[model samples]
Target: MVKCRALKRLKDAPPSTPSKKQAILQHYMCVSPTAKQSLKRQSPSLSEKVLENMKGFIHETKQKRNSDARNAMHVISASVSGEKISKGEKSKAARKLGLQPRRLSGGQRIRTSVLRSEKSCYEFTKRKTRSDITSDETKKQAYDFWISPTVSHTSSNKTDVKRSRIGPNEYVSHQIHLLEKTQTEVFLDFKAKYPDFKISQRLFESYKPFFVMPVKQKHRNTCCCRQHIEVRILFKKCMEFRKNLHASNLDLTQENLPVFEHLNDICAETVCDKTALHAQCLNRSCKECGVEKLSFNDNELDTSRNARDIKWDKFEYTEINVKGRKTRTKLMLVSKKTKPGEMFNHFKSLLETFPAHQNRANWQSEQY
Candidate 1:
C-alpha cells in the first residue's frame, strides 16, 4: 500500500509548463524506485508467509556462516586428546550440534597403515586416488619437483676406502654450512606459514605436525667417536651419556688424547652400526651413512625429519628374523599435517568450498 500510495502521488503531480513537466518526468524516472521495478503488492497473509520464508532463509544463511567460521579446529584422537569419546558419543554430539559435512580431508584422511618394506615405496610415488591428474604438464611438473635429477659429489678422490666413506674434513665443514642454510630456509618458511604457535614447558602447540629429527652422531665413526668420547669423557666427565652425546654439538676442540693408532681396528665397519647406537639414521640417504655425519647434528642443515626419511631414496629394510618368521616392512615417516602459509589458504578455500572436480583436484595438489 505504501508503494501504491507513493506511485499515486507521483502520477497525480500538479500541472506545470511543458519544459518543466518534461524535466519532472525525467527526474522521477531517475529517482522513483517503484517506477523502475514493478510491484504487484501481495495480500497480507501471503506477505506474512513470504516473510516467514525470508526469515528461514536468513537464519539458514547465518547458521552456515557460523559453521564455516570454524573450518579449522585443534582436533585429535580421543586417546591423544585424553578424553574417552566413543564413536557413538561423537555421532551423538555431531547430531546434537547439527554438524554438516563432517568428514576428514587431506593427509589426515590417509589411512594409518605402516610402510615397512622397500617394495612398499611404490605406494608413495603418487597420492592421487583416481584419474584426476591426467594433465601431462601437471604430472611432469610434479615429477620434476619431487624427483630432481641431481648427483652429489666430492672434489678430492681420497682412494682410501675408510676416508672415502668419511668425507674430507674441509668438505664436512662446508656441509655443516649447507645444512645451516637448508634448515633455516625450510623452518622459516614453515613458521611464516603457521603463525599460530603456543609454547609450553614440554610441548609446542602448532596447527601443523612438527618434528625435529635429532642431530645423530655416527655410531660408526671410530675417528669421530674415539676423539669425541675422549674429549667428552675427559672434559664433560660429570655429564650423562646422552648429555655428552648432545654436548658434542657444541664442543669442537680436538683434545690431545693419545693418537690411538689402528683406530680402524678399534672402530670397524661392523661395530659402527650397533642397534643401540643412536648414530646413523635408519634411512639410507642419511649423510651420516656417508661422510657428512656432523651436518644433521645442528639445526643448520636441511634437517627435516621427514625429508631424510622420504621413501624414495634408495629404500632399504632390515630383514628382521622375528622368531624365525620373516616379515618384510617398509617404513616412512611423513608430516601428519600441513598448514599453508598465509594467502595460500585463501586459495585453499576456493577448493574446499565446493564438492566438485576442481575442488578435488585442488585437494590432491595441496596434499602433495
Candidate 2:
C-alpha cells in the first residue's frame, strides 16, 4: 500500500517536469538509468566505459605495428638467407584471430623494391670455393688452366700478367693516377647508369697500367707470344672489364684560353664535342645548338688508355699569384652551381665594389 501510494504521487506530477522524479531517485540509487539522461542524449549507444576501452586498444595496436616495422627494417641491412620469413609467424597468428592486419599499402612496395635492389648488386662477382687455391704460385697454376693451348678459347681469351716473360707476345702498361670531384651531379648520373660497379673515379694522368698482351699456351708451359697479346685484349674487350671507353672525344687545350698571347693571360679557353646524351631535350633527336651539352669536353674518354670516366661540372679558376698574373688549374662538375655557389652576379651590384678592391674612380668608371 505505501509503495503504490508513492508511485501514484510521483506519476501525478506535471508531465513536463519528469526531471524532478529523476533528481529524487538520483539522491538514492546513484546508478539509476535516468541519471545519465543528458549524457545519453549527447552521446547515444556507446557508453563512456566502452569508448575508453576502445581508445586504449587502438593506441596499443599502433605501438605494436611501429615495433614490427622497425624490426622488419633491420632485415634490409643483413644478407638475405630466406630464414626471416618465419619471423612473420606471430603476425600471421595474431591476424587469424580477428585482429586488424597491418596493411602497408603503397609503403610496403617501396620496402620490397629496396630489398630487391640490394640483392641484385652482387651478380657480377665470381664465386670461389675457399679450399681451391693459395698464393702467387697457385694463382699462376690456375691461370694456366684457362690459357692452356688445347683450350678452344686460349687463342681468344688469354690474359698475361707479371708471372710470364717469354711464353708468347705480351706488352706492359705503367703509371696510374686518381682524380675526383666534389660535385654531386656527375656522380649521381654516373651512379644511376652503373649501380653495380664501385662508385669511384680514378683519373689516370700519366702512363697508366691498362693491360698486358698474351704469349704462349698451357701445352707449351710458358707465357704466350706477341701474336697472343692481341688475343688477350680482344678477350678483355669482350668481357667488358676495361674501365675506360674505346673511343671518346679528346680536347685538352680548352681550359687555358689565349688572351692576347703576349699578355700571358688566359681569359678563357672553350672545348667543343659531339655527344647525344648532352644534347638538347627540345627533341630527343636534335643534337645541334643544344645548351644541354657542356661547353667543355669532360666526358667520352679513351678506354684504351684507361682514363676515369669524366663528367666535369664546373670549371674552377682563381687568381693564384700576386698581381693576378696567372690563373690556377681548377675542378669542374657536369652540372652548374647553385645561386649561392655561382662565381659572380653583376646585375646585383659588384660583390667587392664598396670602396674595397676597386677605387672610387675605377668603380664609378666601370658603373657608367
Candidate 3:
C-alpha cells in the first residue's frame, strides 16, 4: 500500500514544481513512519537538493547490493570449480550469504544454493563398478601380461620364493619374479601395448601378481669381482682427489683424473674378445689376454698404499669348542699374499679331488 501511495504521488507531482515535489515528500513522511525515521537518522547537514534525489539514491544503493551479491556468487563458483577453497571456506561463504549448507552422499558438505545455482550447477557422477569398467577377458589379459616371464624375470634367490594356500590342505609354491621396471613404468608400457584398454594406476597395481616384487638395492647382488672392486675403489679415490682439488681452489679436469672408461678402453684393447666375461678373460692364460696396468704421474696419483697388495677379510664357518661342546661359528679368515692364479689353481685342485662325489651329492640334493 505504501509503494502504491508513493508511486501515485510521484505520478501526480508536476514535472518542474517545487510545491508539488514538497507535497509528495510530506505525504511519504506523514504516512510511512519507517521512511520518516530513516530520513531523521541521516546527517542533518544533508541539503534540500540531496533530499529531492533520495529515491534515485535508494535505487542505486539496492543495485549496488545486488551487484555485490552477484560478484560474491561468481567468486564462490570460481573457487569451488577450481578446488581452491576447502569445505570450511565454502561453509563460511554460504553462512555470510545467508545460505544453508547441505551434505552429499559422499560426506562432502557444500552450499547447494551457490553450487547448484541456475548459472552453474554442481554435477555428481556415479562411479563405474570394476565389472562395468573392465570386462573379464580384459582383466585376464592384463593379468597374463603382468605375469609374463619376459616382463618380469623369476628371482634366482631361493628366499624370494612364495607359497600361497589355494584350498583346505592345498597349497601352491610360486617362484617370485622381480619386475624390471617401476609400477608406473610398467603401467605406461602396458598402456602403450594396449591403447584400447583403459586402466588406472591403482587398478594396474592391484592386478600385479603377489609373487612379483619391485627391484630394490637389497635385491641386487652386492658381491662383485676383484677387477670390478678395484675399479670401484679407483673411482672413489678419483672422486676424493677431485673433492680435495675443489677444496684447494684448484681446477681439475677429466684429463688430470683417471676414469673407469680409460681403464675399460685399455682392457678392450689388450684383453680377450669383448664378448667374453671379464672373469673368464682374467682367468684364461691366453697369449692375447693379459693383465694391463694404468700408469699415472706421482703427483696425480696417491702412492701411499699399493692397490695390488690390498687384502679382504673373509668369514668362514669354523668348529669352536664352547664349554667342551663343539659349535660352528663364523671366524674371520685372513688371506695370505697369494696371487689370483695360485688361488684359482688351489681351488681347481680341491674341486678335482672331490669332483665325482660332489657331483653325485649335488644331484641327490636337487632330486629331494
Candidate 4:
C-alpha cells in the first residue's frame, strides 16, 4: 500500500520535473512485445560479455597461427592427408568457414620478376671455386689468356679466366697488350685464334696507330725460292745501310746517296704495284700541253724478271755522288730514320693500296 502510494505521487508531479519512475514507465510503454520478452530473458550486460569472449577467441587463433612451426600449407597438408580430403572438400570447408584463400595478383608477378632478375645478377657476381688462386702460374696464365685474341669476348659469355687468379688491373693491361699486337700480327690469323675476342676491323681502326686488314685466309707458308732469297737479301742490305747512315751522324750529301740505290729500287717496286698505285690513285699523267690527263693501266706484272716497267709512278730521285759526280739517283727517305716496325707498315700500306692480278694485256677495261 505504501509503495503504490509513492508511485502515484511520482506520476502526479509536474511534467517539467518528471521523476525517474515516470521515465521508466514511458520507456516500457514505447518498446515492442518481443523486445520486452528479450529484455526479461537476457541481461543487457550479458551481450557485451559475449562480444568480449568472441574477441578473445579470435586473438587466441591468431597467436596459434603465429606460433606454428611451419606455414599454412603444412597445416593444410596434415589436415587433408589425415582425412583424405580432396579439392572439392577443401573448397566446401572454406565456404562453410566463410574464409577466402590467399592468392598472388598482378602486383605479385611484377615483384617476382624483379626478385628473379636481382637473384640472377647476384649469382653472376658471386664468388666461385678456384683451386689455383694467388699462384704465380695462375697469374701468368690469366695474363696470357687475357691478352690472347681468342679469349676476349662478350661479358655475358665470359671465358674461363676466373680460375686464372689475376687482378682486374692486370687483365686490363693484358687487353692493351693484345690490342697492340693486333697491329703487327695478321688480322685473319688473330681472329681465327681468338674468335671470342670480338675484335673487329673497325675497332682496330679507332686506334690510328694500328693498321687494319681484311678478314680472309692467307698463305701461312711462303716460298723461299731464289727470287725470294734475293729479295730478302736486298731488304737486309738496305736496312743495314740505313742503320749505318744513322750511326754515322753525317750531314746530307750526294756521296752517301748511291749506297741506297738498291733501297730505291725496292721502294719503287713497292709504290708502282697494283695495291699502292690503284688506291687513291688519280691516274693522271702530265701531257705535252702541260695539262694533267686521266690515264688508266691494267694491274699486270712481269714476275719472270727481277725488274720491269711498273709504270704506275717514277722511281724516287735525288742528287747523289757516283764516282765524284753529282747525278740524280733514287731516294731512300723511308728507311732513313724510321723504326723497323714503322718501315714495315709503310711498305705494307703501299702493297695493300691496289689489287693483285696476273699477267695481262690492256686489262684496264676489265676488273681483276
Which predicted model would earn the best TM-score? 3
Worst 10 residues of 2 by lDDT: 262-271
Looking at model 3, residue 96 earns an lDDT score of 41
Candidate number with the higher TM-score (1 or 2): 1
Residue-level lDDT of model 4, residues 154-239, one tens digit each, is 12112211212124321110101113234435446545665755545543233221111222111111232333343444356434
> 1 or 3: which has the higher lDDT?
3
Supply the TM-score for candidate 2: 0.14
lDDT (tens digit, per residue) of candidate 2 on 166-244? 1133222211111122224334544465465342332110111122122332323222333233223322332231122
List residue ranges in candidate 4 displaced over 4 A: 1-140, 146-223, 234-258, 261-265, 269-368
Q: CA shift at 239, candidate 3, in angstroms?
A: 5.8
Displacement of residue 192 (Cα, Å) in model 4 is 20
Cα lDDT of model 3 by residue, 312-358, tens digit: 22334576767756666755353444323333233223322232332
Clashing pairs in 4: 149-194, 150-194, 152-197, 254-321, 274-354, 275-353, 275-354
TM-scores for the candidates: 0.16, 0.14, 0.30, 0.18
- Top of the candidates by lDDT: 3
Which of the two candidates, 1 or 3, achieves a greater TM-score against the reference? 3
Model 1 C-alpha lDDT per residue in residues 33-111, reported as the tens digit of each score: 8865643353458865765654454345534545443332213211111124344465553333333224322112221
Better of 3 and 4 by lDDT: 3
Q: Give the clash count for each candidate.
A: 13, 30, 0, 7
